[model samples]
Structure formats: C-alpha cells, structure tokens
Target: MDLTVIWAFIIAFAVFAYVVMDGFDLGIGVLFPTFAVGPERDRAMNSIAPVWDGNETWLVLGGGGLFAAFPLAYAVILPATYPLIIAMLLGLVFRGVAFEYRWRDPGHRRAWDFAFSAGSLVAALAQGMTLGALLQGIRVTGRAYAGSWWDWLTPYTLLVGLGTVAGYALLGAAWLVWKLDGAGQAHARRLARGAALATLALLGLVSLYNVALRPEYAERWLTAPTLWYALPVPVVTALAGLALLRALGRDTHAQPFFLALALFALGMAGIGVTIWPNVVPPSLTIWQAAAPHRSQVFMLVGVALTLPLILAYTAWSYWVFRGKVGGDGYH
Candidate 1:
C-alpha cells in the first residue's frame, strides 16, 4: 500500500478510537446534571474514573500524527479553526482539572461538577464544529488558510455541534446502563431512550446538511462508483439504531453500549466514504498534504511498534475494570 494512504488510515483509526473511547466519559459529564446527588452521581463518576484519562491518549496520538505526517493540512486547518481548537483544548483542561479536583476537595464538589459538565459540553461542541468547518471546506489560498476568523461559526456547524452533543449524551447513557445496576441503570435506560432518538434524528439531519453544503459531497455519495461504497452506511446505521433502542428496552447490559458504539462507527464510516483521499476537503488530497516518504516510513515503524502496545494496555485497563460499579467501587 502507498505510505500516505497507510498514514491516512492510521490517523483516521486513532481519531475514531479517541471519539469512541473519550466520548462516553464526556457524555457522562454531559449527563451529570440529571444524575441524583450523592451515591448516584458518585457511582456515575466512579464508573469512568479509572479509564477516562487513558482514553485521551488517542487524541494526542491523532493530533501528533497529523502534525508529523500531514503538516500542511494541520497548518491550514488549525489556522482556520483556531477559535474552536482553543476552546476545545481549554475545555479539556477544565474537564481534567474538574475530574481531579472533585475528589480532592469535597467542599467544592458542586462547583467542580459544573466545571466538568460545562467543559465536556464545550469540548464536544467545539470538536464537532471543527469537523463541520473542515467538511464544509476551509478556504485555502496557495496552501494557507484564507478564511476569516469567524468562518467556523456557521448555522451548519452549529447543527453539527448540537448533533455531536446528542451523540455523546447517548453514549454516556448507554455506558451508565451497562455499568450501573438497579435504580441508576433504570434511570440511564430512560435517558438512553431519549438520547438515542435525538442522536438518530440529528445524524439524519447532519447527513442531509452535509450533502446540501457541497455538491461534491452529494456527487461522492449519490453518483456511481462511490455509491456502491456508500450504500451500506445508512442501511447499517439504521440497523444499529434499531438494535440500540431495542437493547435499551431489553434486560441486556453490554448490548446497549456496544450497539451505541456501532452507531458512531457507522457515522464515521459515512464520513470516510464522503471525504476519502481529501484531508482538508474539497481540496488538499492526502497525497498533496503528506510528508516525505522517508518521514512517513520512519514514523510508520514507530506506529507499528507502539499502536499495538497502546491497544493492549487500553484493553487491559477496560478488562481489569469490567463489571458493574456500585457503592464506591473502584474509586
């Protein structure tokens, strides 16, 4: 396979992993307000406390890889979306501080909780808007960003941002359903039902909005050759959505979480189908933005070695922390 293509898939996988892994914990924070005070909230927090920090590793890997292997794309994209990126980073910082401080200082736990929820919500929204702005196409002039500062803040971007929030909320609800029992689980089920509906509705809206944003998107998905590749995404996404709703109603625990993740996976697949070969969208193909062959090969060697290690340890952590959390478990 071509080295640039290999690097592209690697970066894509890293990003996908980050979204699915960190997404749930962020979702937990988004749903934090609805959680009852005391044990209910504590159990919700404890459910993610062990694996939350580690989940962000993929974000670092994805960003660092993009900078290393696709510097041009990163340079242009970052400048165009500086506001969103800054907001996302700041949100992450506050979320991390809240996560740590909530435990250290009980006297100010409520403030920390607010910080956590606000930070998570902001981070999720910013990330989604960044994706939207990129998809809607960043204005590029001779390999540099030519767009104004506020270009990232559009009605379409806002729709995607809200969609992302709803999706994360669904993931969080599904996670709670799997990780908690009794009343907490029941409450999570109720939340998941509503979140699932909102996520699916917004997913449809985003896909339609994407097509309307650019004819290229419409051609890619609706035209021949590409249509064959794109056809199954919607079909499978619908199935996953149905399965998720069914799982939410049933006695199953892990099914709801995994099925919810499937919905995200399908959505990512749809995006890949729509924008493959293009790193910055409407322009800047992966080949155009890729680093030199030697740099990519050298980096690939390191990724090949470390990727498995990251996956192994991440899996190990989850396995170690498996089973329902209740009454101050694993805290």
Candidate 2:
C-alpha cells in the first residue's frame, strides 16, 4: 500500500476521533446555560468529568500525525489560520482551568462556570471557523501559505461556526439523555430537538454554499464518479439525524447519542470524500504535501503499534465509567 495514502487516512482517523470524543465534552460545556446553578449543573459537569481529559488526547495524535506525515500541509495550515488556532488553544486552556478550579472552591463557582462555558463557546467557534476556512480553501503557493490573516474570516465560515455550536450542543444534549434523569433528561431532549433542527438547517445552507458557490467542490461532487460513493455519506447523516430526532422522544438513551455521533461521522466522511487527494483546497494533493518517503515509512510502524493501544485504553476508560451520573457528584 502507498504510505502517503496510509498516512493521509491515518490523519483523517485521528481528526475524526478527536472531533467525536472532544466534541461531547465541548458540547457539555456549551449546554451550561441550559442548567441553573445547582445539583443539576453539577451532575452535568460530573457526567463528563471522568472522560474530558481523555477525549482531548486525540488532539496530540491528530496534529502530530499531520506534522509528521504531511509537513508541508501542516506548515501551511497553521500559519494561515493562526488566530483561530491560537484562540482554540487559549479557550481550551481557560476551560481546563475552570474545570479544575471549579471543583476546588465553591466561593466563586459562578465565575468558574462562566469561564468554562465561555471557553467552550470560544473554542467551538474558532475550531468551526477553521473548518470553514479549510473548506473554503487555503491559499497555498508552492508549499507556503499565501493568504492574508483575514482570509479565514468569511461569512460562510462564520455560519459554519454557528452551526458547529448547534451540532455540538446536540451531542451534549443527547449525552444528557443518556446520563440524566427526571427534569434533566426532559430538558436535554428538548435541547436535542432544537439542536437537530438547527443542524439540519445549517447542513442545507452549507450544502448550498458548497454546491452553488464553490465551483471546484461542485465540479468534483457533481461530475466525478466519486459522487456515487460519497452520496451515502449524507444519506447516512440524514438517516441518523432523523433517527436521533425520533429516538429523543422515546425512552432510549445511548441510541440517541450513538445516532448523533453517527451523524457527525457521516458528515465528516462526506467532506473527506468530497476533498479526497487534496490536503488543501485549490489543488494541493497529498503527495505534494507529504513528507519524505523515508519519514512516512518509519512512522508507519510506530502508528501501527501506538494507535491501537491508545484506542483500547480509551475504550477501557469509557467502559469503566459507564452508566448514569448518580451517587452524589464529586464527593
């Protein structure tokens, strides 16, 4: 198998894992406003406490894979979206600090609560805007970033930022369905319904923007044979979204959360398929962005050995902490 192909997909896997795992914790933070300051909010925090750190672990792997496998692309992507990238990291730092301090002292719990929610909001929006910028296209000229700093700040990307907030909120609310009971569960279901609707609407707008506005994306998607394979991605996303909407009314817990996750996965897959071979938009192919072949060959071994263990450890951690958040949160 081609090492370039292998590494490219490896990077994709890492990114997907990060989004799904961290997405929920981010969602939980986003859902902070929905709950009042009390045991309910405490329960919501505890629901994600055990896994939030673990969820962020994918970031290192994903970014590392990109830097190592496709140095040129990584080089360009960072500089092009530096402000958003810095915002994301800074927001995460604030969120992490709030999580730790919120538990240690109750005197200023409200302050910490604000920090956590604000941090989540900033991080989610920045990350979403980064995604939008990438989808819109990175200005790459012969292995260097050629776009202005403001290039990433477009109306469509900002729209994507808003949509991402709703999407993650959906996941967070669905998680609440799985973990909370009584009023919490009911509130989460309501949030899920609203979030799903927003997501559906944003999905339509994004599709229209990509198809009608971005000619390259439209050309590839409409004209290429790959459309046949890629069509199922959106179909699966729609089915999952619809199923999740339906399941939210039922008594099922994990089903709604799982289906929501499937929706995220399928949407990502659709984007991946649509932009295959191009590491960046406007004709930057993977091979062109790839690092030295020797570097790729050497890293493959480490990836094969390391990735599964990390995934297994993550799985085991989740299994150990499985079930609802009962028993008086945080001692």
Task: Point to the candidate with the largest lDDT.
Answer: 1
Summarize candidate 1's per-residue lDDT along 284-323 as a digit string, tens digits: 9999999999999999999999999999999999999999
**Top TM-score: which candidate number?**
1
Residue runs of model 2 more than 4 Å from their true location after superposition = none
Query: What C-alpha RMSD separates each model from the true structure?
Result: 1.0, 1.4
Give the Å shift of residue 47 in candidate 1.
Answer: 0.3
Local distance difference test values of all predictions, in order? 0.93, 0.87
TM-score of each: 0.98, 0.97
Root-mean-square deviation of candidate 2: 1.4
| Candidate 2 accuracy as TM-score | 0.97
Assess candidate 1 and give its lDDT.
Answer: 0.93
- In candidate 2, position 239 carries an lDDT of 78
- The true-versus-predicted C-alpha distance at residue 216 of model 1, in Å, is 1.0
